[model samples]
Target: MWLSGAMATPIEDYALISDLHTGALVSRSGSVDWLCLPRFDSPSVFGALLGTEEHGRWLLAPDQPGARVLRRNYLESTFILQTRWRTDSGEVLVTDFMPVKDRRASVVRRVEGLSGTVLMRQELEVRFNYGTTVPWMRREAHNGKERLLCIAGPSAMVLTGGNIPHGSDHRHTGQFPVRAGETVDLELTWYPSHRETPEEVDIDEGLARTVAYWQDWAGLCVDRKRYRQPVRRSLLVLRALTHEDTGGIVAAPTMSLPEEFGGSRNWDYRYCWLRDAALTLEAMMTHGYDDEAAHWRNWLLRAVAGDPDDLQIMYAVDGGRELPERILPQFPGYAGSLPVRLGNGAVDQYQADVVGTVMVALSRMRDRGVDEDSFSWPLQRALLGFLERHLEDPDHGIWEVRGDPQFFTHSRVMMWAAFDRAARAARQDGMDGPVELWEALRDGLRTEILDRGFDAGRNTFVQCYGTVEADASLLQLPQVGFLDYDDPRMLGTVAFLERELLNGQGLLLRYRSGTGVDGLTPGENPFLACSFWLAEQYARTGRLAEAIRLMDQLVGYANEVGLLSEEYDTVDGRMAGNYPQAFSHLALVRAADAIHSAEAEQRLRSTQPAEPMESSP
Candidate 1:
C-alpha cells in the first residue's frame, strides 16, 4: 500500500490542536508526528511526518495490545483536543495543545483515565532543524523543580511535566497505571541554548488561558442565517493559522509531505502566502470577523511595506521577507521519500496573480466596512499603480509554475479582477487617482482575456491561451466574480473541466496531464481545495443537490481530526501535499455556506402558509 509507510497514523487516527502560533498532529494511538514549536514557521523538532522515528516524536498511550479507539474531538470552541481510547481493560483520554500562556514557547500533553484502570507509556525524542540537529541533554533543576533541558547549538528545549523518566540516548519514557480520574501533564519548552531557561509555567493556568483564548477568538466569527457549522470551523481554522502576537498567518502547518508520495513534487508550505492570507481575510470578512480583518490588514502592511516591486509573494510569520529555500538530506523523509525541504523557493517566483489577489482582498476588506485610513489607502493606491505598469506582463500563474512563465488565463483574469476591484473602490469609495482610466484599463483587460483566454471552438476556457488543457482553477472565475455563474461560457467551461480534470474519485486536479502546464513530473492527485471549488461552482450554478453531495464527500476526506491536506491521492484515497491546509479549510467554509443556503431556502418555503387572504379586507 502506498500509505503503508507514508503514514505515521492511519487517516482515521489523528487530531490537531493549536495556539494559532503552532500546531500538533496527534494520533489516536497517542503519537505526535508533526509539531513545529516556537512558531508555525519554525523548524520542526518533532518531524516524523517528513521522515521517521529519528526525525523526532512523542507518544503517550495505553501499552495494551490492539487498543481500539472510540473517538476524538476538540474541546468545544477551543484548540484543546481530546482523544478517547477504549481498550478491553479501560478507557483513556489524551489532551494535547500548545499553550499561549505568557507568550513563551510550550507544548502540553495530558493523559487522563476516564474509566477502568489502564497502563500507559510515554516516549519523547528531540531533534532540531528537520531532525538534522541532535541536541545535548541532561536532567536538571529549575528553581528547585525537576526539568530536562535539551540543548542544541543555537536552540534548547526544557521539558517538565508528570514524572517522565529519562532514558539512555536522550529518550524520555514513563509507564504507569492509572484508574478512573487520574491525570498527568507533560510540558515542553524551546528556547535558545545559551539563554537562561524560561520561567516555570503554571500548567493549570496555562491550560485554562489557552482554552479561553481560542473560545473568545472563535466567538468573533461573523455569522448569519447560513451554513453555521462549517463556517465556524473554517473560521476557527483560520484563527488557528494566525500567529497570535504577530498578525501573520502560515499557509499550512507542514511541509515536504508531497503532492504525490515518493515523488519530488513536495515543497515546503510553512511560510505565509500574501495571496492565501489575503483570501483568508476575505473569507473572514464575509463571516463578520472585522477584528481579524483589521489585524491581518495590519500584518499585511508590515509584511509588504517595501517598494511594491520588491514585494515577495510570501513571508515569514514575523514579517521577515528573506526565506531562501533549502533541502534537508538528513531526515529519511516521509517513508524514505528522501530530500526533505525547508523554506519555500516560490518566494523568488513572479506569480503575477498575487498582486491581483492582494488588490481583491483589500477591496473586499474595504467593502466589508474596514475603513481604509490614511496609511491604508495610500498603500493600496500605490500597489494598484504598480499593477498598472506591470499588468500586461506574463509571469508564473497562481500555481507558481516551476518552469517558465506562461500567459496563464487565470492570471490574466485575476489581473482583470485587480483592476476591476480597484476601479470599483475608486468610483464608490471616492479614493482618488486615475479611477476612469483604470476602469477603461480594467475593461480592456477583460476583453483581452475573453479574446485570448477562451476557446470558442471548444466553448471552454483553457489553462492558458494556445493550450487546450483545462485547469481546476478555472472554477475560480465565479469565485472572484469575474463572470456570473450562469454564463454560457462559464457553464461550458465547467463541463469541459468536469470531463478533463475530474479524477475517478470525483475531485478536480489542478489541470489535465497532456499539457504539462506545471513543467514538472506529472501525475498527482486531485487537489482538495479544487474539489471544494467544484462544489462551490455547482451550488452557485443551481445544482444544489449535487453540490451538497459533493461537499459531504470532500469534507469526508479530512482526517479524523477535522484537518485536511493540500491534495488527496485519488488512487489510494489518502491525503497528499502539505497537511492541514488553510486553502482546504476555507473551501470547506465556502461550500458549507452554499449547502446551508439551499437548506435555508427549503425551510423558508416549507414554513410558508398554504393559503393567503389578500382581497378579504
Candidate 2:
C-alpha cells in the first residue's frame, strides 16, 4: 500500500516542479501524489496528495522505512527542485519536476549519486478523472529500449527510466539501489493519445536546456532599487507558474488545498483571474518583462472578444470560458474536507472591480508604449459602456462569495477608477471615447464614494455602506492613489487595521468574523497578501520603522525553499490555504517594490520640499 506518513501540510517538505502547462508538488518521500496534467485546470491523473495514494500517484523514491529528509531547494532561479534524504545506510537525493520546453511533451528526472549505496523504491499509479479511471497501458519499444505507455481519452504519458519495474495491478513497482559515481535519468513524455511517442534520447541535454530557459527568462528583470533577493525569487516563481506555450498564468498549481485545512473553503485556482492577470502583467512589465505582458494582453483580448456583458472575470489559461463547477465524490478530500471540487463556479458572478482592473491594465499598457491590436480600443469602449450601465448596482465584491450582494465600498471606488482611468486614457492617448461623460461620471462617483463609503466620525472608510468594520482591503486606498497616503482619513484606517485585524505575529487578517462578507465558516489564517499590503501601506505613509518590522516578520514565514502559501497560521507557525499562491507572491513583489521605492522617495524628499513627491504614496 502507498504510505501516508511522509506527507507534509506545511508545503515545506514538498518541492514544486512544473512545465508551466501543469505542475506537480512532490514531497521528498518518493510520492508524486499531486499533479493535474496537460493543463493546470485539467482533471488530476494523480491526486493521492489530497487523499490516499490509492487515489493516484507516480512515485519513484526509496521504499525503505525510517528514511528521513535532509534538504530541498530549487536549482538556482529555475523551477527544477533537488531533494536530499539521509538514512542509516547513507544519503541519496531525488531530483523531481517537469521538464520545460516549448509545446513539447516531457518530464525528466535525473538522480545522481552523492554518497554510499542507497536502496530506493519506485511505484507508479495512474488514475484519471480524480482517480476514478484507470487508463489503458502497455509496453512499447522506442529506439530499441522498452518503455511503458498509458493512454486514456485524449491524455497520454510516456515514462523512461532505469531498471524497469514489474507489476500486475496496472501499477508499476520496483526496488533499486544507487551508489557513488553513478547517475540515473528518467523522462515522462506526455502527448496526445493519437500522436506517436515523441523523440527522446538524452535527458541531460533537456535538463540543461530547461535550466537555461528559466535563467534567461529571469535574467531580463531590471528591478534594482531594493529587495533584490526576494524580488528575484518572486519573479522566478511568477515565471514558473506561467504556461510557457500559451503565456497563460495559472492562479496556483494545485486546487482543493483548502483555506481552512479541513474546511470546505477550497477552490480551483487553476483558471486565470482577470484581476490577478492584470496586476501580474503590471508587475512583469515593471520588472522589464514586456514579452509576457504582450502575451497576456493578447490572451485577454482573445478571451473576452465576445459581448461585454458576457465577459467573465476569469478564463481558462488557453482562453476557454466554460469552467463548469462540479463535485468529485469519489475521493474524500484533504483531511476529510469532503466533496473534492473541480472547476470554479464564480465564473457567473459579476465583479465590478474586474472592469476597473482591466481598464487600469490597458492604461498601463498604453503608458508603457506596448502596442495593442486594432480591436483593443474598441473592446475597452464596450467594457466601459457596460460599466456605465452597471456602476450603480450592488453585486458580489472582489472576494467571490455566495452571499447577497451588498454595496462594497471598494467596488464603487474601482468604478470611479474605471471612469477616471478611461477618461485619462482617452484624453492622454488620443483614443476616442465618451471622455467628457466619463469624467462627469468619475467626479460624480468620487462625490458618492466620499459621501457614502467614508465614516466622517471614525475618520476612515468602512468595508461597505453603513458597516463600521475595517477591511484590510481598505488599506488599498493609498496604493491606488484614490486618496493621499498622509491624509488623516487613511491614517485612521491604518490605526483601525492595527487595532482590529493585527494578529499577535504582526500579520493582518482580512477582516473580523462578525462581518458576513464571505458566506462560509468565518475562520482563516492571516492572509499573506493583506499583511504585505499593510507593510507597503506603512512604508508609503512614512511609517518606515513599522514597515520594516512587519516586512521582516512576514519574510520569515517563507518555507525553507523561499516559498510561501496563501495564508499563515501564526499560532502554529505553519502555512495554510493554497500552496504557492499567485496573489501572495504578486502582492509580495508589489509591496517589496513599493517599500523600496518609498524608501528611495523618502531619501529624496529628506532634502526637497514635502510636496515634491512624484507618485502615489
Candidate 3:
C-alpha cells in the first residue's frame, strides 16, 4: 500500500474517497497516502503518495508478509470502499469512507475479519504543511474515551479508536489480530487547533448514514444505461470533488501531480477554476442536478462579487481569491517529480474563455428552469460588460499556457458563445439587456473567427490566429452551437485534428506541447478530456459507431473503480496529471450524454413512418 518498494504507487492505483469538502487517495493495498485536511486546498496531513512514508501517511492493511489485495470496489453507488485482501491463512476486509452531510471533517476506516484470523497493523504519521512539520502529539479524553490529538501550527487532528497505535520513533504503530466475524474501527477528525477538540462520532451510525447519503445522492444521477457504471461513477467523482460547504468544485484534490513526470508541468489543481467549475455545473445540470447548479451559481456570485475587471480565473473553495503560487522544495514530488507546487499561477492569467463558459453554464441552468435572481443576472451583465471592455485582448487560453498571450481561436469562439448566450437570455427569458448589441457582437465575432481563426488551405481552425496547428478544443465548436458538427468547415477541422493531434490509438493532445506554444518542455501524455470531447464530436456528427468505439475506449482508461485522471500515457500505459480530475469526469458525462442523444435520435428516425402522402398533397 505504501508503494510496492521505493517506487510510488501508480497513479491509477489510487481510488478517491471524499466527504464533499475534501478527499483522500487510498491505494489498493489500503494506505491513505494523499489527504489534505479541512479543505481540498489545505496543507496535507498525509502526503506519502508524493514522497516516502516519512512524509506522513495512515496505513491500515494486513501486517502479514505476503498478504495480497484480491479486489477492491466502492459500495453500490457510494464512495464507501471495500477492499478484500487474501493471505495464506485467511482473508480480511477493509471498509473506508468519509461521512457525508456531517458536522465535522472525519475519515473512518473499519477493518473486519471475514474468514480467518489475520494480523493487521495500523500506522499513523501526521505531518503538516505538505509533510514538512511533525505535529506535537498528546493524549486527550473526549466523551468517556481517549483520542490522540496532533497539533501542528493551526491544524489539529484527533485520532480515535482502533486501539490506536502507540507512537514509537515519531510514528504510531500497533499490531492487532482479529478472528473471523470480528471488526475494528479507526477514525481521524480534523479541526482548527483553536477550537476545542470535537466530540467523537458514532462510527457505526456515521458509516450507515454516510452510505445512505452517497447512495441517495447517486440515485439522483440520470441513468444512461449504455455506459451506466462509468457514468454513475463519474458523476460520483464530480460530486466528490465538489466542496460540500461552498459548492466550489476543485479540478482535483491533489496538487503538483505532474502532467509530465519529472517535468515542471506539475501544477496545483486544488483550487476552483471558473472554467472547470462552469463546465462541471453544465454537466451536472444536464443530468438531473439542479440543486448543484443553484449551489454553484451562488458560489460564483460570491466568488466574483467585486469589480468584473478584477475577477480572477480561480478561487479557493470558500471563494477566497488570494491564491499565490509557490513551490514546495521540501517534499520530493511523486516518482521524484520535483517542485511540488502550491496554488496555481494561472489564476492571474487572462483567459478570455472563462466568461463564456460561465455564461453557457448559467444559460443551461436558466433553460432548466432555474430563475435568475437580481444578483445573478446583474452579475452576468457586468461580466458581459467586462468582456466587451477587453474584447480584443489576447489571453493565455484554456490550457493555461505559460507562453505569451495569443488570440486563441478556441477562446475567441467561447467569447462568441458568451454573447450568443446573453442574447438568448434576453430573447427567451425576457430578461432586460442590450440584446441588439449582444447579437451584433456575436455576429461580428463569428465573421472575425471565420476570417482570421480558420486556415482555408488546411481547412482547419488554427490553435490561435496565426498558428496553423489544430487544437483538440476545436472539437467543441459544435458543442456550443457555434457550428454544425458535420459542416464542411468543422469536418475539415476534425480531419486535421485526426491527422495532427490524435495519436494512432485515437487519443488527443491539447496541442503539441513540443511546439513551444505552452512555453514549457514538450513531453506530456494525451489529455483524457480532449479525447472525450472528440467522442462528443463524433457523436454529434452522426459518426455513431465511431463515437461508441471511442467512448468505450476512453471509459476503459478509468481505473478499476471508474476513476479518470487528467491525462493518460499511451506509451507507458499510465495516468498522468492530477488524479480523479473533475474536468475528465465531467467531460465523460457530456460525452456519454452525447452518445445517448445521438443513438436515440437515430432510433427515432429509423422508427418513423414513411411519408408517402406528401407527394399527393
Q: What is the C-alpha lDDT of each candidate?
A: 0.80, 0.79, 0.89
Runs in model 3 deviating more than 4 A are 1-6, 140-146, 610-617
Question: Considering every candidate listed, which one attains the maximal lDDT?
Answer: 3
lDDT for 196 (candidate 3): 90
Per residue, candidate 3 scores C-alpha lDDT tens digits across 1-617 of 33422456899999998999889999887888999988899888999888888888898989886799999999999999899988877889999999887777888998888897899988899998899999999876666777899998899999998586788899998899877899888889999999998877788899889888999998888897799999889888989988888899999998888787777788899999999999998888877999998999999999999899998889999999988988887778888787888888998999999999999999998888899998999999999999999898999999999989999999999999999999999998998899999999999999999999999987888899988888998888888989998989999999999988888778998898878788987888899999999999899888999999999999999988989999998888899999899999999999999999999999999999878765655
Lowest lDDT sum, 10 consecutive residues, model 3, at: 1-10
Score residue 490 of candidate 2 by CA lDDT: 86
Q: Name the best candidate (by TM-score).
A: 3
Report the C-alpha lDDT of model 2 over 1-617, residue by residue, as the tens digit.
23333323445556677787888877666677788778888888888867787788867776566577777788888888888877677677777757677565566667776887778877878888789888888777767777888889888887777766666777887778888768887777777889887776667766788889878887888866566767787877788788776777888888777677667888888888998888787777888888888887777788888888888988998989999888888776776665568888899888888888778877888888976568888888888988888877887877776677778888888888888888898788878887899999999988988999999987888888878887888877776668988899889888888898988878898877636766767877788999988888888877888888888888778776777788887887777777788888888888888788778887788878666657887
TM-scores for candidates 1 onward, in order: 0.94, 0.94, 0.97
lDDT of 1 by residue, 1-617 (tens): 12225554543355677766788777666778888877888888997766666678888878887687788888877778887888788988888888864777777878788899888887888888878787887887766777888888888998886675676766778788878999877888888888888876778888888888878877777675544656677788888888887888888887787777677777788788988888788778777787887888888888878798887889999899888888887766665554677888889887878878888888887777778887887887777777777776777788887877888999888888887888888789888878888888889988988999999998998898778888988888877889988899999999999998887878888886535667887767788888888898888777888998888888777665567878887677777777678998888887777667767777798899888767865
Backbone clashes in model 3, listed as residue pairs: none
Better of 2 and 3 by TM-score: 3
lDDT pick, better of 1 and 3: 3
